[model samples]
Target: MPAKKAANQPRKSMKIKKGDTVKVIAGTDKGAQGKVISVLREQQRVIVEGVNRVKKHTKVVDAGGRSGKSGGIITTEAPIHVSNVMLVEGDGVTRVGFRRDEVTKRRSDGSTYTAHRSVRVSRSTGEEI
Candidate 1:
């Protein structure tokens, strides 16, 4: 018999965003790199292009008494856990880092202030992403 597993696990917040190129760090697709197509925030999973491809047998339900229909195996991407992927920076994979911009901006009250907007940077080259 299989042992019972933990009923609850904390969901982790993912730093990767849509359109970011990432490399699969774990799982069967390890080392496969692709651009992120979508990020499932609640599930902590990311769908990467050309990664985790799975075949789905889909059928088109028609109104003609199901007489004429087309069904075929279609290949599509499957979502992979966020932890199994790493952000790609430059020609290599790098961890993400946050930094504040040094630019200043004027406030609505006619006062100037330092606008420290957060920016994603590469941990290896320290360059903005």
Candidate 2:
């Protein structure tokens, strides 16, 4: 049997995004800042470049190709909880907020359209991010 979806469930959104600069606010990597490489929405975790690094062990692969390949200990970024990082806007860290665009447009058919587009804004300065 499958689980039922709740009607009152709120949509999930992340303040951080790929290529966004962020500062770690907690955990061992605290005080570290880097670009967000990936976001794990289902896990509520994010992988920041140069943050939360972990070592991986692997075995050497078959060297049947043109170049020989060998696997060893590899260090890579691990997922960190999204709540532990803050978006970096300019010189400081700031919370993210969404704002809708106010401009209206007309279609080729001449019908008016006012679709609102959400934008990320800095919480401290209220500036567009």
Q: Clash totals for all models, in order? A: 0, 0
Give the runs in model 1 whose Cα sits over 4 Å from its true position. Answer: 1-13, 63-70, 107-111
Score every model by TM-score.
0.76, 0.85
Top-TM-score candidate index: 2
Which ten-residue region of model 1 has the weakest summed lDDT?
A: 5-14
lDDT tens digits, residue span 8-121, model 2: 877699878889999999999899999999899877899999998899998989787787897899999999999999998778899999999877889999999888789999
Per-model CA lDDT versus the true structure: 0.89, 0.90
Tens-digit per-residue lDDT, 84-128, candidate 1:
999988678999888888888998999997767988888888988
Q: After superposition, how far is residue 24 of candidate 2 from its true place, in Å?
A: 0.3
Error of 1 at 98 (Å): 0.9
C-alpha displacement of 17 in model 2, angstroms? Answer: 0.8
The regions of model 2 sitting more than 4 angstroms off are 1-11
The TM-score measured for candidate 1 stands at 0.76
